[model samples]
Target chain A: MKRRLLLVSNSTLHGEGYLQHCQQHIRDFFGEKVTRILFIPYALHDRDAYAKTARQKFQSLGYELDSIHEAPNPVDAVRKAQGIFIGGGNTFRLLKTLYDHNLVSEIKKRVLEDGVPYMGSSAGTNVSTVSICTTNDMPIVCPPTLTAIGLVPFNINPHYLDTDPNSRHMGETREQRIMQYHEEPDTPSVLGLREGSVLLVEGNKATLLGTTNACLFIRGKPATQHEPGADFSFLLTDTN
Target chain B: MKRRLLLVSNSTLHGEGYLQHCQQHIRDFFGEKVTRILFIPYALHDRDAYAKTARQKFQSLGYELDSIHEAPNPVDAVRKAQGIFIGGGNTFRLLKTLYDHNLVSEIKKRVLEDGVPYMGSSAGTNVSTVSICTTNDMPIVCPPTLTAIGLVPFNINPHYLDTDPNSRHMGETREQRIMQYHEEPDTPSVLGLREGSVLLVEGNKATLLGTTNACLFIRGKPATQHEPGADFSFLLTDTN
Candidate 1:
């Protein structure tokens, strides 16, 4: 089966230059083929700028943009939709809603089982896990029952980069954090996506996209580094 | 079976205190019960600060801290240790070493089967997971591989907190990054541990240490709210 999981980062969707780069990729991947886009407005509660930019991108591609608030059975919605575009924002809120609406199963089927196009930036991309353990949000509001859509098997930490020396107080670096996770045998694979990097998994092939670097940490194995134009399918694709 | 799973996080060990807070909790849970302490110095590359602090902590607790450099067999070292006190630093680096030494399986047994008093802080805590999806560090170095000790079934993103609205574009907020992982299904549960939080499981009783004011995102369920002193055994404990 063939599926398209495009990991758009907050770095791109929030900035014009990065956003343009992301848009160009989206067009490159799904141009003309995309018909309808489901924009997840959960990330930006009061802000519509992300959604606005996404709409503009779709318009540029000659595809229709949709802001789905309430669906009549979200599973049915995915079955009928062409593209599910999750905007970058707070992924926890989006996952909470998706869990409440019970839309994860269908989305999984469409994306992984049925070859649907699932494009998410930041939180939108982060919410598609068995759990959102790798997120950077605080617990201002914990839901009554927290669950995720579970589109991918491992965790995706987007916008991953090196530590800034200008910061005060020294502690574990980003590389250290992921290494500690690998110290255990049961830890899942970690994908550290830098700005402009994307983990593109289409069917059995996985590609790393962007100008920056991304780190893949798998359990019981050494972490592998990948730069732009690297074949990440070496890590992400399931070879059965 | 009493197991000790070491957890190293990127959080301030004492949540603002100078020394790591593992001492305060040690007397109650481990204390005189601890006999051997195997110091994993892989994370603290050139910086001996964390390792030195770990030795002090164990000694103060009246436990023997065995600091060894050249391990003929890392797996055997862990197998013979009475307790493992993994110090804080960078989890990514420590995990890489663990994978290289083929100690992930032994580490898991130490915690789940052998019942060792495995105590860790900061990055030490992060490595207990199968993956460090929720770590708070910069990607300064590429990990040798991806894999963790697998003490816990879930991927842990330590030092998790929301973004401060007052801040400008600096680092990617914890929430923004973890949400990307939540969007996956096959990924395990994510425990976003703020400083002083411990997901301790004794016997069949699993309780989350530290603050209960956490956001738990599981697959197929809505995001749930957790408060300090809440009964999480129902949600987090192993009933099986």
Candidate 2:
């Protein structure tokens, strides 16, 4: 069994419904084999409400969504899950909750070892990287560590925005922030996934999906943009 | 000696020189009696370059700036400093460096108890609060703790921007992020200091200085905007 993952930059595009933009990709990635998904709604403040919302969305897509918060044993829930979905919210809160519940390793084992299909958007996509260091979410809570489940070789910066040439905002631009991230010693490359973009990975292959271009941040080099449908499997190879 | 502090939202406004917009406020906060200032350039990646740039800026303001990086004894440098300035870059890196050098306590003691006039902008302003939890900077590096020098009762979110009603960007607005910060149990209020705004604290009283209005984020309440020169001293009292 191969490691299958659908890492979306955001759950919804500007005018789309919940996960509407990536619905086809989600269907194709999971296929007809997986009927149920263990939903991790810990990233959100209202876990029950978030789970309820996600459950409706997944059910509309013809899959049963069971929230881990409702499970008596989250670890056992992950162990038995055929597919896993982590919703978007605060990355720090999500990581902290996962660490607090000791579900990090179980989720990793289920996804990587047991070949359970994994899907995440926004905060969910961020935690699938080498570390949540590149996430754009506010650090509302401090996790035990910055280490995350490295489903992918590189870090994912979800909701990556281009520098607005006409804007006078003094806050660091998305590119500038990613450049600053590279300043850290031994930092890995980062994928600036634009809204509506998805990184689909199967075994050792990774492909950039969607209509927009994704920005890539490499250490000691100028950042480059990759168009949709480009092969990003090279990112899996250790750059260090 | 009363504790005097100048917390600026940004170092430079649009098309202005470094610290150009707030130079007058800087001089006013420190006064003519304080000629020599100790500078902390740890927030930036290029510490030496950042220090040199800030040194020139302070010199232009008629004060000698000595970077702590160049000081043989950092703690001693903080102890004997007439004024302290923390230049903005990345808040996490700044706090980490301070914690690594064990300068958090010394700087806190000097600014809070010793009445050595302290000035900070952007990341600098964020750290002068209860914690760096409300900062807008990317977490490039993880500090030992999110705890920062508690110079003020509430946290500061510098370079805070108003939500653009016309914009289609799906990223959370600055206000939304601050509200999410408040979602954490018992989190303090967050002052959304916009660009060109300054928070001037003298002992028990804090005033909102500069030309623009600053937004205040109190838990479970609608965020309110405060005009320039507003009396924000009430923030010092226990809100929880």
**Where in model 2 is the C-alpha error above 4 Å?**
none
Point to the candidate with the largest lDDT.
2
lDDT of 2 at A99: 92
Fraction of the true interface contacts (Cα pairs closer than 8 Å across chains) found in each model = 0.06, 0.64
Best by TM-score: 2
Alpha-carbon deviation at A149 in model 1, angstroms: 3.5
Model 1 chain B poorest 10 in a row by lDDT? B231-240
Docking class of 1: incorrect
Could you list the iRMS of every candidate? 10.0, 0.8
Please provide, for model 1 over B1-240, each residue's C-alpha lDDT reduced to its tens digit, 9 standing for 90 to 100.
565443433335433543345455565566575676787777666435655665676677777676534457778889888777666665556666677777778878877888887766666777776655555543223354345666656666566565668654434556545555555446556666665566665654556656425667665456565665554445334311
Candidate 2, chain A: TM-score? 0.98
Candidate DockQ scores, in order: 0.07, 0.80
Scored by TM against the true chain B, the candidates give 0.82, 0.97
- For candidate 2, lDDT tens digit of each residue in A92-195? 99999999999988888888888999999999998888899998888899998888888877899999999999988788998888888899999998999999
Give lDDT: candidate 2, residue A193. 95
DockQ of 2: 0.80
* Model 1 lDDT per residue over A101-211, tens place: 667777887887777788877777677654565654422233333345666667777766566676443455566666655554455677878766777777667778867
